[model samples]
Target chain A: MKAVKVILVLFLLSILVIGQSYAGTIKIGAVLAVTGPASFLGAPEAKTLEMLVAEANSKGGIKGNKLELIVKDTGGNPEKAISFAKQLIEEDKVFAIVGPSTSGETMKIKNIAEEAKTILLSCAAAEVIVNPMAKYVFKTPQNDSFAVIKIFEQMKKMGISKVGVVSSNTGFGKAGKEQIEKLAKDHGITILLSEVYDKAASDLTAEVTKLKANNVQAVINWSIEPAQAIVLKNAKQIGLNVPMFQSHGFGNIGYVKAAGPAAEGVIFPAGRLLVAETLADNNPQKGVLLQYKKDYEAKFKEEVSTFGGHGYDAFIILKAAIEKAGADKEKVRDAIEGIKNLVGTAGIFNFSDKDHNGLDINAFEMLTVKDGKFIVLK
Target chain B: MNTQLFFQYFVAGVTYGAIYAIVAIGFNIIYNTTGIINFAQGEFVMLGAMTAVTLNNFIPLPVAIILAVIITIIIGALIEILFIRWLVSPSVLRMIIITIGLSIVIREVALHIWGDGIYALPYFTGTALKTLSVGGVFISPQILWVLGICSITVIILNLYFKYTLMGRKMRACASNRSAARLCGINAKNMVTLSFMLSAGIGAIAGCIVSPITYVQYDSGTPLAIKGFTVAIFGGLGNSMAAVVAGLILGILESFSIWLMPTAFKDVISISILLFILFVKPSGIFGNKEALNLKEF
Candidate 1:
């Protein structure tokens, strides 16, 4: 009886010691699409978060507390994201959740995080994620509206008022169409033609040919993946010679390469990561962007995409929030809202009650494909 | 619409349709011999396109194309020998489920090997296949290549099946497997040959379309669906019907975009297909007698 009591007392003491040590660590939850069709988005994001956490912990972490990042793969599915968000908030008791890589998944889990009263710093680009003032949610990527506005600004500078829009039938495409339609008139632009194609359509020649017939000055395509690249190739094939602009979805160099020579002179709006080297010395995002680019490339042996940049900014913003507010969820939420002038790979973030993204049209840089690579359009 | 607009739409439809037709022909080959719709037909197309793009870095384009086709043929044959041959007694339902499962496996394996980046092959002629402007309608040379290759493939297949001894044995197995086996023809060997032939054709189709569409690991299913639709419309195992049906589907899909919103393209095509099936239960060119036979 005496030996049994002694062993139980020692086990309790060990539990107390382990618990005390882990109590000082901050836990951040991430839901990324690491293996699904959107693995392109999730793979880089997971890498970015892992790298940032390791780097911070190596340097003694934020405010001298060790950082623990728990990443879950959603495989780009919304149901998976919601379940993961619940696990992070209810079971793991993370102070904050950083991502559910795609916009659709982020929206699906927004209420969960809000109910849990934990901050969600999403890496996805949809405007709906941040608009309407979701108190507990913030995002790093420039909103789709900002991407549209940036494209329009470039169009205005070139004196191209009449434009044609070819958007995909998917959520991203449909949302982009709405933004373009809503903002075009405000920008003194007239949409000559607007059409939505199947995201999986093998060819868009008919659509391009129709746009050319309508005599639009420029064409804007909004979608992800092969659709964006295929439109450019189809335009070249059917001789739609006007300037073509794509949404931020065209950020990846792989798309540019896929379009081959057809990608030349086609412009799009994207984050600063693609043009990190070309950013001027005084640019706010330059230093951090360069460091991230070098570190990521060195470790992964692949070029850094803006999707990864979004992940990097998520942790960066969270680190700042944690530094100011400690590990309290409510305080972290307020800290995240209070963050301002935080230079990140996406842009300088300035959060407020009215704005969660804290980014405007300026967050995007107008980039054009030149010689199978992205070049900043001066 | 003006002549130029019509021509532009026509060219677009034909180009797109030709890809479907080639895939349809591939389906016809396997379906004719085994009475099974090789659901992995599209994977063969994807594999061919992916392999060619991968090989182009090391070898010349022409050599890469040939090698890619050969590789697909070998893969098809291997699939037959290893998986399909082991089926206790092949039923259409069982064969279909197996092919579907195989397709998923192939796509996942492809993802692991190549990653998920979209890849495109260069235009075969070195430069962007110059768009030939005829009276105001622009047509890409790639379109011509697609149409040309598709037609040649159909003609060569027809000639081979009609003339070659090995092809005859395969046809004999298709018409009556038991009789062919009784006559000392190896029905299983003929099935294997048919798979190889279909895979080769599907691979070539992939190579032809890759420059325009850009091939991804997941591209096979859509291509397969489109191809299956074309095959059904043309009468399942009829080569000539496949070509005509492919052209018709492609042109209609293109022209419909002008008449209605782009979203209705699939709706319009599938509706037309349904209407045709409603009118003639045995597709446009499919022989009812052949379809009635359980073996073929």
Candidate 2:
């Protein structure tokens, strides 16, 4: 009886302490695919968001109001996520929204966020998620166009002239094609052959052999997971090994492990800022990002990959907006749009009235798999 | 277009084709002997590769592979006796569902035990990059192993089916279960034998290719589908045709990608399957003069 009373007293006291820290509570909603095929991303994203929120609350909360995280599962479906976003804004009345991963899914709810005048901080890497001028959408991930352009830059340095590109016929892949086409003339690179594979399509041999026949010097892949590995193996089997490259999304341990020996020498453009020890001295988002990296590694029990770091930055950006606007949805929207030189894990966010990505072209980092890990060469 | 690279691609394609052919042969054996399809055949590959990883910690690669095959064969037989026997019926849909369910259970169990991380099995010689040059094309040792192991399997299987009494019983069971049973043959044991053969063949494939592609918890589905596709393309139960079809498909796929973009490669393979369905209708070596020639 005595022990029970003592334990009850401690629990009550802790709750009181927690309550006192967040006297002005701010509700922040996050949507991710917590279950299903893409749960790998959702599981990690949810954990990271909760940790950041807890840390912020412990440190007197964000601007004296504790961040309340309301997370829901989308199961990696885009249509279902639009409903989740609507409910989060209307029923939950969250001041800011965090995620619902992948560009394809994010694009589904972009218009909804805009109509509701909700500030949606998307972590998906599709360029169009922030394009076509959505006032409320700001992306934390590097759009596929930027990633492909980075690859093209590296290809120029390698003296590559012509390349065949294979992209998933999804929102992100289309964006990559747009970027690659725009840069073709500048780099003196010609698009020899282009092929589109649906997400569920497997056994990609005929298309790969066709690319080889077209006399393409290089192959660029813009997809994720087992499919990417399949492409590499098929290309190698057909003797089309002219220094193949992939997008940043393919830089996970899953791709490397599945590709086995095929993964060697495959180059791709990953967000290199995550790999650097620190951003430059004048880099706006350096200090917060360094602290984020330290705290994330300590909490997650894993290395701070770009995904986790992206989550951390997105959280910070949302928190800063809420603090500036006193958790008012309309004011938060204005603050996010008007931001200038706000330091983040990826790079400085210099969002203006016209450009919402806030990225510097200098932030590009080209990488290749070396001994079963991504090594940034550019 | 180059002679050496063409040779390289040819050898590599045939080598991969051999692996798929053996997997298809295993599928055909179980399907023909028993009136069921084991979608979990890929899990046998996962099991074999994972077993090699564990055994290779203590034993040599060859010993590990042999042990993996033996254990998988036993497991294959046990699963048939315990689960598949009860589930087998005249309803084809039910059998397919049961096999799919078994595959899920096997996959989840493997994932629970091993987690989702990919494991790299060491190559037999620890020399994956060192290639055998013929003319101008380079061939890796993995290709050679896939070819040599598959050839040995085909020869042994040919001999077993042609000369051995047990093999004759298996063929009898496969051709007609009721007739084989009425003729005093133990159809149940023959069914078990088919599973044993399949699991062992799949294990062999896993052992040969694990050092090349490695293995993960969910690596079974695509391999199963490819093997199934190959089996279907060959006339379902025809082992020789399956091998030939696998090689043809592999080579055609490898060379066909040279004419299209690499992304649309899957569509091309699927299109060929559709084309075969329309033109040949009964597959490459299908049994003729039969009204309803069911394929596994």
Candidate 3:
């Protein structure tokens, strides 16, 4: 009994000491869709954050204080995201948070971040996250508006005036549709046909047939996953000769393989990370992009996607802020807003008081599938 | 509508209908023997497709397909014996809940094994078949494959139920379990056989449709729902009705995209199912006795 009592006391004392030491570290939390339907986005995001955080720690962390990263898997559920955000803020009391991979989940946690005054550097690309100018929230991925602008500009250059828009009924697809509808006319493009499809739809033949009948010069498919590949297959099978443009959601090479031969010549707007190796010698984003591409590919054994790049930017920007202003959440937020000309994997980020995403149309590169590989579109 | 566009929609409908028809047939085979809807019927299709895609990396396409179907049948039998058989006179509700549980387990296991990425099986021909245009309308060879397999499956099932003694015994078990057991038929074996048969059919459907849609861990639920709708709308246990109903549902969905917004495809599907239930509670060809008996 005496020995057991002494062991219990030693254990309690060690726990107290360890806990006190841990409190000295700067805590950053993350809510990512790591295991659900959107795992494709979240998995890479989680990996990038983990790797960057480890590297930061190895370099003696922020201001010689170890950075503690608390990552919660939201599983792409909005309720779970909200709860995770709340837990990160109220329980973990992290100085900052990063990611809630999808637009819908980010939206669910936006208010919580503002209320808690915690810096939320989200990985989602929805314009709504930063449009209303939440005091504490920002994002890393290029917005749907930028993608739409790039696509429209490409269309004009290609001398294509008429286009069909096919969007999935998901938040990402709907958000892209809204931007496309808003920007089409300004670019002198006609919206010949706009169709929405079930995200799980196995076929888009009927919709593509209608687009063909309408004589659209190009087709813009705004969605991800099995639907994206299925649409391409259906379009190819029906012999629809028009150029096919996809959303940045097509950044994953799995999509190109799934679409098979149909993927060839399909163009989409994506960040510079996709063709990092091919960037010009003096390009601002080239060095950071190549390093991240190399590190991520070497570690994960898969090609780096813009989704992962978003996570890398989040950590890179957060690291810079922490280094500048220490671990104070308010100071970190201000430091982030004041960041300028920070070349990242995504773009040359120029955050300001008014703009949160800090990426413009220049951040996007129009890429096309050639021989089942991504090539930079000229 | 122009004839070309009309034909395009027709082909789309037929191709989709072929998948739904196979799912419905799987439902019918299980329902006829067990008197319970196997919610995992869709997962069988998913497993079949996923297995074939995974195996194709090592084996020839035809051999991969055969292996996939056979593996699916073994899984089906195991599910019946390991899980469903242990129930002590399971209520229909219990059986349904059990199958739903089974589906969740299988889907999660698939997720761990395959990861979240969507996978596609190579086309049987190794490369895409060029569209064969009739006048202005176009059809891919894969669609033809889907149609051919569907027709062959329906014909085979029809022949089996009518001419085979084992098939009749299974139907006998479905209609009156105690009576069939009294007649010296092993009702339990019949149930296991039906599950294996249904799984084989479902696997075939998955393998064929995969080239068009691609398959992922989560693909099973939607396929299951669509198949369930087709089965119910066609009269639960009647295989012939299931095929016709599946085709109708597919065609209606195909045209609905042109007639209304694309988001309404799922809405139209559920709405039509609800409307059918309200108008014809026995389904289009539902046997009044069987339908009423299963209600409990």
Candidate 4:
């Protein structure tokens, strides 16, 4: 009887010690598409988060407390994302959740995060993720509308009033198409022809010919698929010599290589990360962008993509919020909204109650493919 | 549409048609001998192109293509020997399932090896931007290469089947397996030879078209579906009819984009396939009596 009582007392004391140590750590949950079709987005995002967390932990973590990150790979499935979001909220009880890489998965769990009052900083590009403005749901990627506005603003400078839009039938392409149509008229532009082609289309000659028939001043191809590279090649083959505009999806150097010589002189709007070396030395984002690009390339032995930048932006934003709020979920949510002029790889973010994405048209830089490489459009 | 635009669409249709016809010929070669669809036919094409692209890094383009086709032919022979040789007259459904399973295995293995990156070979005559213009119509030189190689492949295959002793033995096995075995011919070896022949042709087609269509790990399935449609429309075992059927389907699909949205292009082609199946089960050129004699 005396040994049993002593054992019980010692077990209680050990539990107290373990529980006390865990109390100072901030637990963050991330659901990303690490293996499926969207792995292009999620793989880099996951790597960036893992690198940043390790760096932070080595530096004594945020505000003298260690950070515990839990990453869940959804393989770009919304159903898995829903289950993971619920599990992270109810079971793991993480203070905050960072991503569900693609826009579809992010939208699937937006309400769950809102109801649970856990902060969700999504790395998706869809405007719908934040336009409704759930108090607890914020996003890191720049809005599709901002990208569209930047493209239109450049078109206006070139005196191009009529354009043809071709997009793939994917969520990213469809969302970009809607934004382009919605903002074209506001920018004094007229869309002569709009077509949605299959994402797996082997040839896009017929579609490009239709744009030629319409006599549009410029052609805008909106897709993240290899079909977009086909579009560039087909348009050049048919001798449609007008300027071509691609979506931010053309940021990958692989696409330029796939299109080969045809990719030259093609323009697109993208984040500053692609042109990080060309930015002025004193620019606020230059240092952050270069540091991230250098660190990511060195660590992964691969080129740094903007998709990873989205994940990087989410972490830094969350770090700033946690620094100010100090592990209080409600306070972190408010602190995120109150963050202003935070330098990130995507852009300088200024969050407010009315806006959760916090990026403007200026966030996009008009980039062109020149000599088979991305350069700032002069 | 203007005459130039009409011609432009026509050229596009013919380019894709030649590709489909080649793949359909691959299907017919296997279906003729084994009575199996060999759904992994498309993977042969993918394998050929991917191998050539990798080999092109260390060797000249023409030599790389030849080596890739030979490699794919060996793989085809191995697949038949390992998977189909000991089946002892397997049911048609069983063969179909096995081929489908094999295709998935090959695709996954390719995904692992290649890492899902889209790759294309350099154009043979000129760069991607170079085009030959006749009147107001612009023609990509790569399209001409696709058409010429397809025609040459079909001609060479026809000659081989007509004049070669080995080809005659394979045909005998295809016509009457038991009788051919009694006549001192190895019917099983003929099946392996048919697989190699089909794989070789598929690889040739894959290499010529990779410059225009681009090659990826998963690009094979869609090509396979289109090729299967052409095969069915042309009569399952008739290679010559496949050429006509492929062109008709391709031209119709391209023109359908003019009347409807581009998203419905595949819908129009597949609907034609359904209509053909419902109206004439033996296909446009298939003899009803001959189809009745064969086992599906």
Candidate 5:
């Protein structure tokens, strides 16, 4: 009995020490694909959150407490994400969590977030992640359906009727193609062909040949950058003179550089233009963009891509929402949902009850590659 | 929907099958010599592909390929000496777990160094994609490359094993490490050599693939699994059989794409492997009684 008491006293003393050392910080846990193929998204999400947290503290923090971001890398795997979410919740005692940058990874942790009543702001853009609608869950990232909707609007404006969409057989690609097909019909666009590429595909000529024979005016590419670029190169090689309509993903200059001159006239609905001249002065978010651009460019010492813009947006939205909520969990959730006309590096992000995504069609500034640089379409 | 479509899918499957076969060869070679199934072998493909792309961005294709291979060979050897050398005598399960953990670490390190974003790599020569029509079924140059590489790798590896003294010593080390040590052969070097060779092959696979399919950091794991499965089905330690096994999986998956949804392709392969394990534990080309739980 005496030994048990002595042990209990030591445990209490250790707890006191731990509590004393790290206290008064509003902890927000984040899960990102920090070490996988999707690290492209997670790295930015992680970096953006840090910048936002630092900036928030510099301005006296949210309601006088510093914002602490506890982050984990999901590595683009869904199974690993569930465990990491649990770790952040139980071990870290975080106030809320953000993460699992891909839709596939985000889907794995949705139930855990619901059971824990922890607010999860997912970065993946898959429509199915939140289709069933979990409470305490919202996404700042755009979904496939919205992307398709944005692309459909552009297709309608381009006056192109006959369309061909080639997508990978993965869940994300299939869903996008399905939504594009449904929206294409609603938008009065004729579907010329629908093709599928193997996930392990290196060449796509056999698939492209069928699409090429269809006499489509434009091709909607719905695959990751590598396969998508393969399609563009092969299509151009086969002398298919159709305009290619790409998803927001093709906005990366790396894709353009990979496709070389063949990527010219390829139109995509970009979430943000990292180096657009328009955002420097006259744009509404000029101040924010200017600050973010200055910091990001200085750190990485390379030109920022649209992905960096996403990083800038994720962190800013969280900081602003936290400030408005004054550290109250319910209030912060409310603040995030109630965010109206909140200017971000991406654009003026306005969120409401009906819409979870803050950005709209206007946010997707249409752009094309001209002379190796993105020429913003008027 | 028709026979022509069937033929198209079949041809597609054959092309894929060939690539997996080449991937499997690396698995077979490493397993044959080391008795340790290195999971990061797939990362060699990622590394190789990424390296080729990095090099190709600045230099010519031939030079890029050469540089990619050399870098991968060095990486493979270093990984063996650094990580696998200590785990050489552990249980196969431990080795497998260690390799998977190492793979995770490798992928994370890759992610940190190379930020996420899908990169598009062009096929050889940065040339226009060319297709051949054989008997009304269309085949692309990429398929030809995949098939050509696998064939050459199989023949060369088989010849080396049969002819070269170093290759014979490798076989000896794989078969009887104690005996090989008694014969004054550097058994440790043999293990490292196997890793280097496997890495070179994996690099070639990656280089050819990135230009064809597009690679990301996480893409290596699935390919690694597929490669392991092909080696197992064909005979885990049989390099030549790995080639056949890779092709078999590719063609089977290609046909299955038409018969079933592509999402369950891995499931189908898993089921097939399970059946094979239950009925024929020795695999296609392996010894029936070689199932002893032994050390490297």
Candidate 6:
């Protein structure tokens, strides 16, 4: 009985030592849509964050403190994101949080993160996530408005005045459509027609046919679903023959392969990651872009997408801030805001008190698919 | 509307209609034999397309498609044997819930196997950009293939039901299960055959339409809903009515975009479904007297 009592005391003493050691480590929480509909975005984001954290630990702990990553899979549900956010803040007491991969989820947890005074680096692309200027929240993806402006700038360069817009009824598509409509007049462009189609539509020929009938100078399709590829094919099939512009959501090369020959000459705005191989040696983002592309593709055995790059930017920004401020929550938050010209896979981020997204319209490079591969459009 | 624009809409409607009709026919084949609706019917289609896409990596496209259909048929039989056969006259609601659960399992399994990537089979004859222009109207060659193959499947199914011994026996089970068994026909085996038949046809439709409509892991659910709508619109168990109803729904959906936003396209079709169910529960082609005699 005395020996058993001694063993219990020893076990309890070891738990205290382990708990004390854990307090010295920095805990980073992530709420990602690791499964379900948004898994395409969150899966890559999760994998990238896991990869980067592993690499950081392997190269001696960051500032002599090991990192503990706690990823909560919200499965793209906003309610789940809220609960996960609270849990990460209160229970986990993480130093900072990253992701909630979709815009809706990010928006839902925005206030929770702010109220808790925890730093949040969002991976979603919606402009609203940063435009209202929450003190503690920052987003990594380039603004939807910026992507719209880049497309319109390309359209102006081509002297295309009137264009028809077709977007899927997804949040991404709706946000892009709203940006396109709101910015069209400013760009000296006339919107001939704007149509919203179902995201799961099996055939878009009728929608494309309407666009053809409108006799628009160009066509813009904003969507991230397989339906976008269908739009491309339908436009080609119905002989629309006009230049087609897509949103930054067209970053995945799988869409191009799915569209086959129809993908040729399709233009969209995206980060430099897709065309990193062609970027100039002196380009600020070229090295970061290439390294991430190489590392992610090598580790995951899949084509690197901009979605993953958004997660990469979020982690890199957080890491740089933590390194600079030594894990003090307020100092890390200020350091993140003060960050300037930080090269990332997405763009050279320059955060400030006023601008949280840290990306300009120039962050998007006009890219076009050619011969079933992405290339920078001249 | 201009003749060219009208024809374009017509062609688009027919292409979608063909696939919906095939899916509806798949529903009918099993519904006729077993009172229970197999919610996994759509998964059979997805499985066929996904299997063929994976198989095409190793073998020729034609061979891949054939093997995919056969494999899906076997899967259908196994599903019936494993899940449904032992149940002793299970309630329709219970059976439906079970099938729905089965569909979720299959979809989750598919998600794990395929990951979250969109895949499509190459066009049978030409590239995605290839189209045949007639006067001022354009039509994809794959659309022609879709229409042709779907029509052949329907006709072949009709002939099989009319001429084949197994088909007649299955029909006997459909009309009177106990009487069919008394006449030395194995009603349970007939039910299994019905599942195989439905899965085989669903697989064929999936392979033919996959080039036009890309297949993802969750693609089956939407197709299943649309197919269910078409099946009800035509009548529960009448395959011929499904063809006509499917085309009508497709054309209405395609043309609905002309008057309203394209987002309301599904709304238009589904409203029509509700209208039919409220007014004529027997469906457009279904005889009211015959429907009254049959148990739902």
| Error in Å for residue B120 of model 1 | 1.5
| TM (B chain), model 6 | 0.97
* Tens digit of per-residue lDDT, candidate 2, span B1-296: 76655665566467557667767877777776665677888889888888878788899878988998999899888888887676544466776787788888888788767655556466666454455556655566676777777777777887888899999899888777778989999888887788899999888888777655557777777677778888878867667778888888777666655554445445656777788788875568876643164434
CAPRI tier of model 1: medium
Candidate lDDT (C-alpha), each: 0.88, 0.74, 0.88, 0.89, 0.75, 0.89
| Position A13, candidate 4: lDDT | 97
DockQ of each: 0.70, 0.30, 0.73, 0.65, 0.26, 0.87
Cα deviation of A112 in candidate 2 (Å)?
Answer: 3.2
Looking only at chain A, give the TM-score of model 1 against the true structure: 0.95
Model 4 bad stretches (over 4 Å): A1-21, B81-89, B162-165, B168-191, B293-295
Quote the lDDT for B269 in model 2. Answer: 60
lDDT of 2 by residue, A84-199 (tens): 99999898777778887777778888888888888888877766777787888888866666776778778888899899888787665777767787878887889987777755
Ranking by TM-score: 6, 3, 1, 4, 2, 5
Q: Write the per-residue lDDT of candidate 1 for residues A263-365, one digit (tens) a residue.
A: 8999998988899888788998889999999999999998899999989988988888888998777888888889899998888888888889887778888
True contacts kept of each: 0.75, 0.28, 0.76, 0.65, 0.32, 0.92
lDDT of 5 by residue, A1-378 (tens): 999999999999999889746656888898987655666677767877777788778988777888888888877788889998999888886788887788887788888988888888887777665566776777766556667877777878889888988888776677788888888878888887777766655555556556655678889988764677778876775557788988777767777776777777888777555445654366676576667777776776766666656656666677778777776777887788898998775567888776666767666667777877777665
Models 1 onward score TM values of 0.95, 0.83, 0.96, 0.93, 0.80, 0.97
Report the Cα lDDT for candidate 1. Answer: 0.88
Lowest lDDT block of 10, candidate 3 chain B:
B122-131
Enumerate residue pairs that collide in model 4.
Answer: none
RMSD (CA, angstroms), candidate 6: 1.8
Better of 2 and 4 by DockQ: 4
lDDT, candidate 1, B1-296, per-residue tens: 78888888888888778878888999999987887899999999999999999999999988999999999999999999998887766777888999999999999888888888999778876456377788877777777788889889889988888999988888888888889999999999999999999999999999988988889998999999999998889988888899999999999998988887788889977897898779875688877776787543
The lDDT-based order of candidates, best leading, equals: 6, 4, 3, 1, 5, 2
Can you write out model 6's per-residue Cα lDDT over A191-213, one digit (the tens) per residue? 99999988888889999988988
TM-score of 1: 0.95
Docking category for candidate 3? medium
Task: Supply candidate 4's per-residue lDDT for A287.
Answer: 95
